[model samples]
Target: MIHQVQRSTQVGRTTHSPKRRVTPIYAPGRRHPVGQVVGDAFIKHIAFSKHTLRSPRAIAFDVSTLDDAERAGAVVAEIHDTESRNVWTAPIALIRSKGFPVRRGFGNQWALTLEHWSRNGLQSEAEAREEQQAAKQAAASVVQLGLFGGGL
Candidate 1:
C-alpha cells in the first residue's frame, strides 16, 4: 500500500534535468576546484600565444588533475590543434603565460588582461638578455685569469 501510494504521489516528470556545469578555476577564497595548480594557489587564468590575439594558442579544457599527470612545476596538457594533436608536458607557468583570451566563456573572472601578458613577455625577455650579459662577463674573466693572460 505504501509503495503504491509513493508512486501515485509522484506526479510524473515534465522535462529532463541537466547537470550543472562546474568550472575548473574559481576566484580565491572559494571552494577549491578539482585541479589545483601547484600546492594551494589555484590556476588563476590561462593564456597562450606570442603576446597577440592573432597568434595561435592551445585550448585548455576544464579538466580535473590526475595523479600521474603532474611533475614538480609542470603538468601534462592535452594539445589540440589544426595541424596535429599531441600531449605536451609543459611547465604550468608556460601554460598560463601563453594562454589567449576567449571571446566568451565563464567570464572575465577566468581570463587575464592583455597588458599583464605583454608585461610578462617583456620581463622574460629582459631576464634572458641579462643572463647572456652575465655569461659573457664570466667568460671574459675566465680568459683573463688564464696562464700569462693577465694584461699584456
Candidate 2:
C-alpha cells in the first residue's frame, strides 16, 4: 500500500520598472534621409572642392543626426600641400552616401574644371579679349560669302 501526499511551495512576485520610450532623433525629407544628412553635406563639400579648383588640406565632418548606438559614421580627411596646409570642416549627411555615384560624377567634373584652370593659369581679362578676337578671326576666315551674299 502507498500513501500519496501533496506539497505546495510559495513563490514571491517581482515587479519590473516600466520601459522607457525613445523618441526618434531625425525626420525624413524628400532629398535628405532621416539620419544621413551629414554624409550628404560632407560629400558635397568634396564635390565642391573637385569642381571649384579649391584644394583643402583637411576636412572635418559632423554627424549628429546619424549618431546612434548601432552605427555612427564620420568623415575626416587631410590633404597635404608642399607649400602650406589648410583645414576645412563640415557635416556629413546620409543623402550623400546613398547618392555616391552622382556625387562622385560631379566631383570628377569638378576635378576636370580645376585641372583646366591650373593648366591654363586662368585667362586674364586682356587674355580673354585676345582669345575672343582670335576666335572671331578664325570663324571669319572659315566662312566665305557667295555671289548672292549668302554665307557658304
Candidate 3:
C-alpha cells in the first residue's frame, strides 16, 4: 500500500505538505534565573571594554524594549576630540543579570534603568581617609586592661 501511494504521488496531482515552523524556547521573564553565566557574559562583552571600564568624558545608554520584555541595550561613549562616539552592546540575557535591580513596568514587564557611569578603580582619597578613620576607631575600642588586672 505504501509503495502504491508513492507511485501514485509521483504520477500527478499530489497535495504538498505545509512546512512546519519552529518556535524557540526562551526563559520566562517573571521567573527567569540570572546567574554567573549571565554576569560573565555581560562582563566579557560590555564591562571588559576599555571604553566602558575607563572613565570617559561622558557615557550614555540606549535601551530598546521588546514585546516579550526583552531589551536591546547599548552603551555610547564620548571621548574627547573623537569625531564619533563608541558604542558598546551586550546580550539581553547578560544585561538581565541577577546582580542588577529590575522593576516591573506598566505592563508588568521587567526593566532595568541606568543611572550613572563611573570607572572601576581603587578608593578615592576621601574614601581612603574614611577607611583609615574607621580602622582607628576599631583599634581604639580594644582595651589593654593590663593582663592580671582583668584575667592574668
Best by lDDT: 1
Query: In angstroms, what RMSD does candidate 1 have relative to the true structure?
Result: 16.2
lDDT of 3 by residue, 1-152 (tens): 00001111222454764333211212334232211122112211233233221222222222212212222111222122122332233335433441133232323233222222212333334446778999987665554434336423
Error of 2 at 139 (Å): 2.3
User: Which 10 consecutive residues of model 3 have the lowest summed lDDT?
Assistant: 1-10
Per-candidate clashes come to 5, 13, 0
Per-model TM-score versus the true fold:
0.26, 0.18, 0.21
Query: lDDT by residue for model 2 over 1-152, one digit each (tens)?
Result: 11112333234563544333222223222233222212212112224343233342222222333233113223422222223333222222322332122233322211111111111134434446778999998777656444447766
For candidate 1, the per-residue lDDT at 48 reads 36
Candidate 2 Cα misplacement greater than 4 A, ranges = 1-110, 118-121, 124-138, 146-152
Residue-wise C-alpha lDDT for candidate 1, range 1-152, written one tens digit per residue: 00001111222573544432222433333464423333322333333342123323234433223221233222433222223322223333544565444554433312222322223224334346778999999888877878566743
Give the least accurate 10-residue stretch of model 1, judged by summed lDDT: 1-10
Model 1 misplacement above 4 A:
1-52, 55-74, 85-89, 96-106, 109-138, 147-152
lDDT scores of the candidates, listed in order: 0.36, 0.30, 0.29
lDDT for position 118 in model 2: 15
